[model samples]
Target: MACMEEQRAPGHRWPYGPPWRSAPGGAEPGRSGLPWRSTLLLTLFVLVGSRFSAHGQPHRVPLDGSAHALLLLACVPLLWRYRHPVAVPFVTATAALVYLAAGYPYGPVYLAVAVGCLSAVVAGHRRAAWASVGLLWAGHALVALWLYRWLPPAGDKGADLTQEIVIATWVLAVLAVAELARVRREQWARERADRAQAARRRADEERLRIARELHDVLAHSISVINVQAGMGLALLDSDPEQARTALTTIKAASKEALGEVRQVLDTLRAPGAAPRAPAPGLDRLPELVEQAAAAGLTVAVDGEPPRLPPGTDLAAFRIVQEALTNVVRHSGSRHARVHFADGDGMLRLRIDDDGPATGAEAGGSGNGLAGMRERAVALGGTIEAGPRSDGGFRVLAVLPLHTREDE
Candidate 1:
């Protein structure tokens, strides 16, 4: 989770994070090698340790014949431990109790019960695991106490016995540490999955935003060109020269808008693909203004600019594009002015037009203004747009050109 926070922190790479350690090709949790190996190694360890103990101890009866057969039978369920851990441990524990009751050597059975206790701890509820371990240990202790009554005469072997108990405790502690590692690995896997899901959601939202912008930009532009083309056709017989000029301008504007729309659509079609060209930036403002002019919106630019970061450049370009689009659609304006300047550690833009009164009927209830404001604020800037008290609409933005290094 902490890794997720670091990867998504502000000012880091947007939307996508760096690559993660993926699950191996064609490997899945249940079908992977891990569970099989865990079962196989544990089974071998139990069987070998039992045989070795019987051989080492002269007094202990060798677990052969029917008793040995029963012990082997009890362990068949051990292979199911990873998938049905609680069931395996419960069955094994019952078998261990019966084996000890049948008066066989308890050492091998006791060790099996200990391994089962560890599995139960990991796979069962915390309270149930604690209860199971305590009950098994107490049963083993009682069996040991009962055997003490018939054992050979006592010997002075206190230090040796203490050392053996210490070693056994250390072995159990090591096994518990191994279980802890397994749990932490599972936690990391879950965190990685969650991070991937969040990144996908962010990508979907960004795609939606791009789609919305394309719809507004292209739909509105094409609709205007259609209307202008029809008007030119109707006027051709009466006003041949004016109609011819309008038709030419419409062709040029429609072609340019189509190219821009195609570029945006290509991005939407395959986000992972490399772009054919960089997105429009402030350097392309002249081309954008020329297209708007061809659409019959007279536009003038007045001012100089400073070198800017790419992000700022894109934001500036989009702002102008959206503002000019609004003028053509709602302003009924014959002329528009765009002013840009950089000073006092800030870049300022002002767009205004002398046009007719565009009321609520014209669909100019600040949707474009709000979109422009959102764009500016995302890059640490501000915008204000409304009817300019001077009988025109004004869209103005003040953006920071300098900030702290951390920004």
Candidate 2:
């Protein structure tokens, strides 16, 4: 985050204070890297502009070599503004005050002070920057109000209190400009950080979606294939006809798994492209039942599934699929039950299986339950999975109908 603030914004107007930290590729349009061009231009402008202002204010002391040197001292510190923010403002302010006391004509000599002060403020040294400019103004007010008699260009009368208004305005203008630059630079930084954080959050959500898709697709299909392969091998010679039916189930399960896996991979290949096939929904519950039957488990689905948002429908399908897969893989009883109903804009799902503690004998990564919970939470829903008191495993999910995810 610290490094974030040092980089430059693409097209911010000010050059002294740092803005957005985009790639510093060869000095962007509004951002400067070394600031050498602007520094040189500023110094030259002060020199030339002062020579003209002095001619116009003849009563003031002329621009001699000493006055030129003091002006140079003030402007040169600006080159080191970024590296030495606090020091630069004081150096420039000191020079401005010394030049004023010497009676050099008031002119563009203040521009250097302004730049240094703004740099300090933008660099997060607000107190130091304010104090530096305050010092210069205080010193100038003293000289112009009382010290004029002892100062150079001897026959001078002290300035009236009314004349202080002009000086006050200049100081006010510098402070206002510095404060504005500080605020705008911070705003750019906040916006940049927010954009970066948002990008990361979106990436995390995508990874999760892919994980759930892969897990649900692979877990359920592979479970069926595992059962059929076992059946085929056990009865390969003892009952050749039964073995053939098992092999055919294996073929169909593998082909469907491949298709679904390929569909998932397609999403990775071309994000934001429409899915090649409609996502599986509760309407495919019969297919789920058939696949379970092939695995030697009985699946009975009760109650009609209602029309739902695509996200909700997909979640409902995945949850039911995962539950039935768990039953086929982990339950001793070959019968599983799935019940779903819609009421008051909510969809309720319940899956149950007769069980007698498969425990360590059942092999699974244990991510299915968590995945179901994630799906439910994303749609403002909930999932509860555990054992029933009557020696059965149960998974219950309550999903919302009005859930909306950004397209």
Candidate 3:
């Protein structure tokens, strides 16, 4: 029962568990957990080592049946190296030490110890890797001393020096390769995380932009519709012709609103589809003034708008539209003036109404003003809006044309 419980413990499985698994989700059945390819390669190394030992290679220690079993014990644990990176190196190193102490032949069985060291480093077990290296060097020195005292010399001093150099070079190379792989994996993960964050930020900005569009389109249209409907109802019994005209204005405004709304929805639903109409810009200001006049607000234009970048033009139009809508719905203004000017590489817009400030203007949540400010600021511009001291409300926006051109 204790054995079963140990196996079931998180990250403490004897053969495989939490830290052994690749990342959060489980790895493919044969690819990660089982590692059949590595098993096959280890098997090949064992076979080759056995054959070389049997043929009396100078470097190979002769192996009896018990030494052969010890060799298998050292190498077989490598199958679980990835699952227990730190543990695997310690187990293989201990097995190799036992084999060496028992005077078994040093053959390809040491390959398992090298692989475990590499695995520990790649698995981010830095302390374990250093410990394994220290243990390996200490064991090697002790074994050499034991051989010098108890066994006949197989080679000269020069031959022993060359072998030591080669073994040290091999160990350093394994560590270098594992460190490089870990660095590369970490870099890739960081880059993937950055890309995901950028995508989410762009998505949030797009949602805000779409919301602003919908609010401007719907709010302005519904305000006009409400005014016209009210006028029609007030005049229904006395001025039938004027009432019919008001109803006609309402119908025209509603139809235009529906079309604009559908266009925005189409662009949202099918981004690759052809646009139903060009976005509103400075050139559409005349039509906007007409719409306001028809809705019973007398609007006057001061100067002609210069040609502008698409983004700036769209932003300018929305700013004017939102400001005019406020004058009509909240300002209680009969007359409003829109002034446009281009000078000093900046396009300037000023809208003022000769009406008393309403409660909505002073104490409202100001989503419209906030949205307009966001749009202007996004284009590297500024806007100021407040109730005028003389008698009314005013909004002024300054946009940099040169900045748009440079972009």
Q: List the residue pairs that clash in candidate 1.
A: none
Each candidate's lDDT (Cα)?
A: 0.63, 0.85, 0.76
- Per-residue lDDT tens digits of candidate 2, residues 1-407? 22222444578554333433222132323555567767899999999999999988888889999999999999987877877788999999999999989988989988999988988887778988989989998898899888888998789888787778878887888888888877877776677677677667777788888899989999999999889998999999899999999999999998998999899888777766778999988888899999999999998888988888889999999999999988887888899889988898899999999896566344577899999999999999999999999999999999998775633
In the range 14-64, model 1's lDDT, one tens digit per residue, is 223222211323222436443455556656666677777767665544576
Whole-model lDDT, model 3: 0.76
lDDT of 3 by residue, 10-45 (tens): 553332222332442223233645666776788678
Estimated TM-score per prediction? 0.75, 0.90, 0.82
lDDT of 1: 0.63
| Residue 384 shift from truth in candidate 1, angstroms | 3.1
User: Which candidate do you rate higher for lDDT, 1 or 3?
Assistant: 3
CA error at residue 313 for candidate 1, angstroms: 1.4
